[model samples]
Target: MIQRLNVNTEVLSTYIRNSNTPIEYLRQKLPNIDKFLKGELEPTFNQVYALSKLINIPTGLLLLKEPISASSLNVDFRTFNSELLSDISSELKDTIIEMQEKQEFLKEIVENECPFVGIFTFDDDYSDVILKAKELLGNEITRKRFDNYRKILGQLGIFIFLNGKYKDNTHRPLNLNEFRGFVLSDKKAPIIFINQLDSKTGQFFTLIHEFVHLLYGDSDLFDGEDSKKRSKTEAIINSITAEILVPKELISDMFDNQIDIRTSLDSLSRKFEVSKFVILRRLYDLSMLSRKDFMSLQNELEAEFKLIENIKKNSGGGNYHNNLLFRMDSNFFNHVNNAVQQNKITYTDAFGIVGVGYKGYKILSRGG
Candidate 1:
């Protein structure tokens, strides 16, 4: 006779509700789910294991007497609309946990040598914070800065990852509108993950925004919303990011004379290596653009950005290996490779840490 195990009905219900799986699907999988829920029948170990796999919950949790309550993530999701919180899928949560585990491993081995991870304090003024960040970055925002931003972050002992799709289901891509970036604050090993599906300029801004969260030692998610209507903490960080990217004095110098708004915006965007949205915000902030003109240009720029994004999506096929290296950060790759070379970790373990297979690892090893 097969031994039956008592499963917590409340925990099972809560897991199913929180997960992407449907109730009907669960009912189909466990034909006697109703009986189980009613406490009329106990679940077999196999049934419990299958339910765990389906809902992405640990089987051990189901065996508990009481329902397990999930701990809050300590992340503030900045959004105009609260509904976007629902988009935080199980895959995303699992990805974050996995990244944290990897970060812990790195911290254990390399924390002593890395001193820049928790250099900033929340008590520091935004101006001072920005200056220190730039000093650590080794340069101000420029046309080529994006290429080296990740390297700078890595040098500061911040691990950054870029992923467009859910780790478990590649078919379901992460929605950029829901969250552009998130930072997990740890003194020894802070981590930031950016949604690569966002526009390049948007990604740059998100990096800075998330970095600001790390500076304050706050774990949070930044949904690319209007900077004007930000929360108090977000407003402070947004102002800092703007000033760091486009200094008021520098922008004032650029707009000394009257010129075509469109032409000047294009020129300034290229010069500052930021989105037109950011450039326009600076201009509006400096009283350079009239409110009416600012609103008009903002709408125009957003439409154009969407069109360009759609065009790029249509023109597919990019180098997967190089892109992986970029998402993983070159400095991160170097650290992992160094660890492997020093026999601290095997190549297989390195591959797992880097989120690549043997062939992909070979390509990354070749610096492709």
Candidate 2:
């Protein structure tokens, strides 16, 4: 059965502008859309069809008596080095695909439950609190320990999934920091596509930072460039994430705020169980040190804190995702298991539907 609705052209125009459509993408499909929007022309079937394609929505839904704003939108882009990923092993590709599918699933759930909306809701003070907490954990924690923390957090509703994987092409050198994470606007789960080759520490920090983004209800990509031009919300989230990882009271108790940069860095690093670089970042967030101090400390730790090499060959098995999915309590896994066992979906089709590869299917089946 098919259904249709007639959406007002004026309301639709408002929706388009508010949503931040790049002019080029808009112009490519509906050249006359501009004219129709400018004037008060009633939208035609063609216009509705064009909009349906652009928004990835059903055509008839456009005719609803009231216009509804999408809480989230999916945007896909290849890594800066998409061509390079071709030579990467198939297992890596499979992992990335699985991560992406799971992220999309989580996003669908979050866009609806967003509690806070707007800029002022996130402030610098809120962020400092998170940083202070992280500091208290101290430097004794290993990457494995942090992973366990993340798993526990996931149980509490922090969703992280892969966004994309990166690799070097024949022309370009491989970028070890290949994966990029994104926070969706509605406080749903954030996305994290890891470099199958990077170290556990960098991945852990990214998971924590991206989780902070989710808490703040944002949807933006972190380019990790320019410290000064950050949006207020971003600044707050960064602050909060730092605090959550290495809290303020703990740092204050361990070292004087006015201590020498290197001494403080080492002490804070040891105390928080985080890298010295992260500790330095936390200090900057606290406003206890000048920008120059932060930069100097950053440079000092650059060599030691440089991202580790990626695993190109057999990275063997490390499935944070598998562990997550196989844990019977996960909603997606539970739903998938029930559907398959009840014969709602054939085993072959179930594998295709969930986008899990053969090995994943076998593992999931065993878990069930």
The candidate scoring highest on lDDT is 1
lDDT by residue for model 1 (50-169), tens: 676788765545654555444443234433222235345555555555565455455545544445445666567777888876777655555577767766777677778888875323
Q: Model 1, 286: alpha-carbon shift in Å?
A: 1.7
> Which residue segments of model 1 deviate by more than 4 Å?
1-87, 113-124, 139-142, 167-169, 221-230, 338-348
Candidate 2, 28-69: lDDT as tens digits: 887766766565445544455466558654443344334543
Over 4 Å off in model 2, which ranges? 1-120, 123-145, 162-179, 185-197, 221-232, 256-267, 284-294, 306-331
Clashing pairs in 1: none
Model 2: lDDT of residue 242: 64
TM-score of each model, paired residue for residue: 0.72, 0.53
lDDT of 2 at 338: 67
Instruction: Write down the lDDT of every candidate, Cα atoms only.
Output: 0.70, 0.49
lDDT of 1 at 241: 80
